[model samples]
Target chain A: MTEPTLQSDLNSFDLKAFLTEYGRLVVAAMEKRIARYPEESRVTQAMRHSLFAGGKRLRPILCMTSAEAVGGNKDHVMDVAAALEFIHTYSLIHDDLPALDDDDYRRGTPTCHKAFDEATAILAGDGLLTSAFEILSHAADDGLLPAEKVLTIIAGISHAAGCNGMILGQMLDIEGEHESLTREELEDIHNNKTGAMIEVSVFSGAYLGGGTPEQIAALDVYAKNVGLAFQVIDDILNVIGDPKVMGKAVGTDAELGKSTYPALMGLDGAQDFAERLINKALQAIVSFDNKCDPLRSIATYILTRSR
Target chain B: MTEPTLQSDLNSFDLKAFLTEYGRLVVAAMEKRIARYPEESRVTQAMRHSLFAGGKRLRPILCMTSAEAVGGNKDHVMDVAAALEFIHTYSLIHDDLPALDDDDYRRGTPTCHKAFDEATAILAGDGLLTSAFEILSHAADDGLLPAEKVLTIIAGISHAAGCNGMILGQMLDIEGEHESLTREELEDIHNNKTGAMIEVSVFSGAYLGGGTPEQIAALDVYAKNVGLAFQVIDDILNVIGDPKVMGKAVGTDAELGKSTYPALMGLDGAQDFAERLINKALQAIVSFDNKCDPLRSIATYILTRSR
Candidate 1:
């Protein structure tokens, strides 16, 4: 599969401009909704800090972009998109706890536990996680979609967040930490940890947008490819990207002896693998109309982004 | 507000029969569902141990009794009942972790982290928590209730388990460990920790049983009283009850200098308080028919149980 040239894709659509606009809307909505929690508790404040801290709202953007590609209103997808961001944020907060990653820095800011206390950080993660489903269940009040479809979307979100997916991924990641991992072992970890929620972002939008079975199926393929590509790029960035651009400490993967795409395959080979996956993602979107150009550009952006 | 005599209220209710029957069913169903995951993974096995370890299936029994009080089928409430147990069990597993309670025993069996590892116990708790919602969503296939009600029940369960409720209680409990707590402060902690889920169990069963607004209102009051009384009894038992019956260490509450109703109110004052709450619980059920006898008896039983 031939990958789309990043230069040409950037020229066709201002990738940064689109992401920036969508990213602003996504982050603003997430922050506003999270802030709606009563401000009395220190835990809620800590949760808001972790949630609103500056990171590219990539998951929510993917959700909104997919909805727009399917001709659904972007406004209709805002709450759902925010809900995706909540799930993503919750995962990060939990992952950074002392029992988990024990990282002090994330996105150039102190992690939730470092900024607050460990117990507060744990509760903050729990708050964000439960709030994600709460937001999804209430999406029907927006009147942008039918109640049944909203339920289906919630179910999809629940499944992705549940034991069969992201939680399982975290479990495997913990287990694999002290043990050496094979290529297949590493793939399985990334697939659950990152791939599950990423897939849900697109499929949930497709469901809300009233896509047919075939479109939903096609979007799943696209989501899986992009998800894997996203992780591969992350692994590569950890090894070679500028610390200023990447935000957090880089090369920690090698320091921790964690398995990575570049570790299994050399840096050049890992880049090739990411490029191949990006092409596959693009191919999955071929049946869609030109509205899907954003999706294609985003896939290319996955490979080309500095952060 | 005179309390009903224990012999008059629960002497004939056969508590052993209820506990044994419901306990077996709850454990079997939970074990079967958890075992569906690959056993080779240490985390999955750890999750199973935490889930299956011998504990009184008190929450599910409360749910079943609540369903019966409304003249609803026992099987009708089984899924949600099981779900409540799962949530309770997951919280216990997480609470027993080194980062949390750091207990080595639960119900006379090894704590999850002791039986497995700390990381596996964490993931196991995560898996179980997420699976509770999954089980509720899939309850539609059981044909006992409409999907919409199931969704509403899920929403309520999420709210209780999330930050404002049980998790909040946990945060407060941890914070209270080194501090002197006022009576109001202790009430807030107990309300969020145990009372939230206890309240939800009644509401969930009522929702499924086609309870009227008045019945639901009445049950809410009934639940509040029993939930608190349940905690008061637990506190008393910690100081004076037989450890053989309680299954885990007793007096550890005082050893840890934890706040409790008895600790703050004194034994006689706590007893008076329990009587007052039990009377309030009975008053709430005065509007119900003879079908409410089981609910009334259970409230009385809260004061009389040794373990």
Candidate 2:
């Protein structure tokens, strides 16, 4: 399929409209998957409460856009996109646990533990994590991709989200609490904790979309820069973004003594880094034509997003 | 490969020797897999602590034995077996959390939370859960099974282990604490919490082993009965077995006001029920020849085990 006419008309780009149309699709897929369980059950209720809670649905959107950029079908990637959201949501739930970030609210509402109990929240997180794999396996069964490719995707995702990836980042985050970290150490933490999953999200989409080796390599480069920029922006937001706009309180990273980009680099320096990274991200995808505009816009949006 | 002579030599069968030989293989594989991570890392250390704590490698053994019973090679099923143990170990780590059963020790050693911090313990559990999928994906990559079959196995296991299965069971168990539960309610909890995963373990093994539909169905029935009996025997052991022998405390269920077979039924009645269940388990596989002796022996061993 050729690039959509609307995508080529970049001057008329509307991030809100784009997200609304695509985000609804992602949310619908997520809801359909979650609805398969008994709705009245507490665990189900807990899962739905957090899942349907407000978020921008960025990861799933990124995944779908990455797939489309590679000339892959959106229908074929929807399950995987939803799976990414599930994993993302599960991580948020766990991060809100009393033992972790201990946040009372997320996205301006009661966190899972605050909505239910700690035990229920933990189970809900676990249920979501396992459910993500379940959904991907079904995607393979549904012939979204060859089973071998799906298996490869699953393995890649597990590694990215597992100990040496997101979990490692989380471990480093917890350990770094109250301790000062060098810029390098902080980069290592964010790369593992937040960047790994984001990179995998994009890589998974490109792979499932049947991108060529060169295309996948370019997207990987693009995703890494985007991921780093995304986290840096997050750090900047925590320092200055309004709580209401951001959907949660700001400055908690500093309050908790987290090793954030703004803490390691000065605020202006962190902002400069995010801008440079986004430029690099756009440059990595320069070989692709208008078909990849969504990715390009997303890199720009990551730096400019209020939340 | 036909049944090994030792498996057919029922008169001279020694469960200890059999478990020793096979258990070593399962444990060694598990150790090798765990060793892939950074050795000195805290999360890895926490994961290894519970993983190598010397539980009877029953689930993995069941997986391998089921595969063998169906004429599939052990090497083909080893990764799945190890994945099962990873899931089992992760569940134990979570179950031992302060918000859950609050056990200080498992297998006569400090629980993960007690040994490591609670956050590390939680991350360890998460790491193991993700790693299980990672290993299975590798199994697919290694050509252990057709990718389609591997995807099917992953879906089945997730359904059995996720909200509707193990997590559901766990949620029910937590909610039922300090409350009176009818026999049916308790059964539902155990069936989901314990039986679901066990059933999946056997089903995965049988499916991956290329079992015929009839063979898989029979194993499912056998697994259901064996799983329930296994839990029942666990209750009996808690009430009567020595702590040193069991390698954990006894009577905690009763103390927590949790329902058990011995609670609803008298001691003799519970024991009788376990015997009946084992017989039913054995009967399910009776259609097969002496090649199925290990399964039959496992059923008997479940009833007779001290731990």
Candidate 3:
């Protein structure tokens, strides 16, 4: 496939506005829903500390945008969008625990375990994970969607976030520490670690928004390519991006000796590879028309992001 | 309002036989379901290590028995029965982590973190947590139950297991350690920690088994009362039970300065309280016929067991 130039589309489609419009709805939903469980306790406080730590709200926006791509009201699937972010936030909390990645800070703030006691951080992660299912099963069943659709969404997210996907990837990533991995092996890890959730988020949005199966399938191809490209850019930016914009130190991936696309393909090779992936992702959904512009724009944004 | 004698029912029904019958089913279900995620990985091994450590399987049995009491086929709820145990096992693994309870041993075997590395154990716990929901949404939708029933059960389980229930209880329990807690405070922790899951286990079984609303409500009362009695008996056993039977050191609760019924109320007082609780649990289900004999027997067994 020929690589597509993105300078015009990037300038025309205001990615900031798209993110802000969906992000505001998600934040409001999270606040209103989270109030049901706060109970004025420390666990809720810890959950909120990590949750509101200025995340870019990328996953929920993807969900909402995918819904809109299907010519459905994005607000109808807002709860599920919020749920995707909850699942993401929970993974972040656990990933930053002392026993896992041992991250001291996230988004320029102390990580969950660093901000709270280790035990509380662990529970905060557990709480958020369980709450994701709670919100999906509870809020999604309030007559907005059919029960079958809700169950399908629940099953999808659970599978994407479970041992069959993210958890297995995490296990493999931990085992890969201090060891060299082939490009294929690194891709396998990233596909499970990152690609599965992203693909499911898009799938959920389309399905909940009443898209045809063929549409979801095409978006599936779109999501898979863009998700992996997003990870590649993350690795490249880690090595070469400005620290202030990234919200944390740079070159930490190299410091940890982690395997990455750049490590296997070189910086220029990785960037060219990411461009190729984005071009293919865009081609997969070319038939969707202006309704899918945000998805198309998001694909470009993922390729060009600094952080 | 009146204490009911259970000596006749306890003598008539064989608690050991009841446990063995349902325990065999749960073990088989766990073996079959857990196999789906094995992939021959260490995380799966760690999950199995903690899962098969041979706890009493009280929760699963309660679930099965409640289904039977409601005149539904017990096997229909077997997958959910297994899900309850998975949720329980994951909690035990997390509770035993170094940053939490920090116990090296559980049920006379090395804890998950001790048997494997800390990161693997944590991931194993996470894997099991996510897997429980996967099994529910994926397997429960296979034409056995209606989508509404399946969603209702999932919502109930999530509510009972989320911040509204088990996680909140765990947080309070940790904070209660090394500090004194009143009787009300201690009961609050046990209610959330132990009572919520137990009550929901019975509720899920009854609901899945097609019980009437009144029947499920009655069982909920029975479950709540029996659940507390079970924990009170646990406290009593910790202080005075034989180590050979209990399979771990006794009096550890006292060692940790943790508050318990026996610490707040005297040993004799706690025993009396447990007896009262069991009697009330039995009374709640008095209208049921011989189908509830196992439930009656289990309540008596909880109060009178040596361990």
Candidate 4:
């Protein structure tokens, strides 16, 4: 994970440089906004702890890239880009609590509840959840997009993160823990749990970026394919990824008795499935211009990334 | 608590019918929206369970009442009024968790986590929190208000529910639990924890009701005074009010060893303080016409309410 090597078929666009540049902007936006709150608050500290816990800012990067791909300035969607990260971080903080997954560490550091206490972690998640909306709605104040469009984006993102989306997915995940799940059940869980937010991130950025109906439709297809591919790869990595390369513990998913792509299918079958998903995803965005090269590169990165 | 009594001087308006009519609208909105989700989802059931768990729909009632008081149709702020109730319910679900308040019951029924499991309750809270924003943002699609105003309302409400408002208040509540708190400290906690959302509920309704600056200003003053008075009344009820009338336990605050107005000041002192605050609240709205009588009656309602 130290250096992202282009180990897959496509390498025309340098994914590393793309991530570094846009990811920095996303982090800067989040840091600047979070800095406005009081430093002495324990919940703020807990939020900061999980937020900066060394993970790739892939969701926001995908969003910013999608915005640019559709002929919009990345700056226009920067607040929302940061908001995606906040939502992800909040989910992680809550997921790691003792009543849920109960993980002590995330990304090689203490989880929010482990770093602080359970009550603080819970409130920190609540704060970040609220803060994400604050960022989303305030995007209208700067005239970043039309107020109508801002409301549209909020509706879409909130839907993805809400009842039938990520929350439902999380509920399904815990429900399937004790029993062996069929391939369909596992995919259903991951599709709702992980794929929903990822797909909406791409769709939201494009819609807010003023993409045409056709272009947004196509990107939605691409997003759905790629989002699932990303999770398949994550499951693959958890089973076989090197700890040094992944920068986190390996085989933890297996240890947790969780259903995963590799667990459902053999390693080779899982990898092949991931490859097919990437191919389908790339096909969906074939008509977009070279501005979408980052999107193309991300598809490759999903497969080639060792982490 | 069973029948509204005009114990104080300002019972010119029918407060019971006001609550019944507006509260039913708020509940209907919530029920219709929630019905669209999958019935089999445990999270959905958990959300429904706590949401329907019969408490006074006071917050949303206040918002709708404020909108009416400011010369706007109550229907205009109905969605946001429902959103307020969702936020309040979400906070209650999370607050009652074992990691937080650990309460087994609310409104004479099992708490969310007690009715379902902890994980389901947590996700249910997450669902309702996100759904609140979904409702807030989508109000624009119905032409309920201008998109800009919708965005403004979303920003304001999210801020109140987020960092320096309710979330901060909850964090401070736990932080102050083990120690004797000054009156200022206790007020700060109640102001943030309970007062922030309550005050914003008033301000948001007034703003969305198309109140003029002068009108909104006066209502803000009224809201702040009544918000604090409401908390003081709650504290007094926990001390001496009948559980049969309250339909909830008495002395739970004292059991928690939590900070309270009655803890800092004697019961008589707290009662007198609430009276002064209610009077100030009444005086702030004195310039308004009879349309604001509901606002005035609510001030009296806070004092005379046995619950």
> Could you say which candidate leads in lDDT?
2
lDDT, residue B278, model 1: 90
Candidate 2 — what's its lDDT? Answer: 0.87
| Cα RMSDs, all models | 3.3, 4.4, 3.4, 1.8
For candidate 4, the per-residue lDDT at A46 reads 86
| Candidates' C-alpha lDDT | 0.80, 0.87, 0.86, 0.86
In model 1, the runs with Cα more than 4 Å from the true position are A1-12, B1-12
DockQ of each candidate, alpha-carbon based: 0.49, 0.77, 0.76, 0.87
Runs in model 4 with CA error above 4 Å? A1-4, A7-12, A244-248, B1-8
Where's the lowest-lDDT run of ten residues in candidate 3 chain A? Answer: A1-10
Chain B vs. true chain B: TM-score per candidate: 0.92, 0.95, 0.95, 0.95
Minimum summed lDDT over a 10-residue window in model 4 chain A is located at A1-10
Q: Against the true structure, whose DockQ is highest?
A: 4
TM-score for the A-chain in each candidate structure = 0.95, 0.95, 0.95, 0.95
Between which residue pairs do clashes occur in model 3?
A: none
Model 3 bad stretches (over 4 Å): A1-11, B1-8
Q: What is the lDDT of candidate 3?
A: 0.86
User: A152, model 2: CA deviation in Å?
Assistant: 1.0
| lDDT, candidate 2, at A35 | 81
Instruction: Arrange candidates, best DockQ first.
Output: 4, 2, 3, 1
Per-residue lDDT tens digits for candidate 3, residues A67-130, read 9899887878877887888889989889888788888878888988888889999899899888
Across all models, the iRMS values in order are 2.0, 0.8, 0.9, 0.7
Model 2 stretches astray by more than 4 angstroms: A1-9, B1-10
TM for candidate 3 is: 0.96
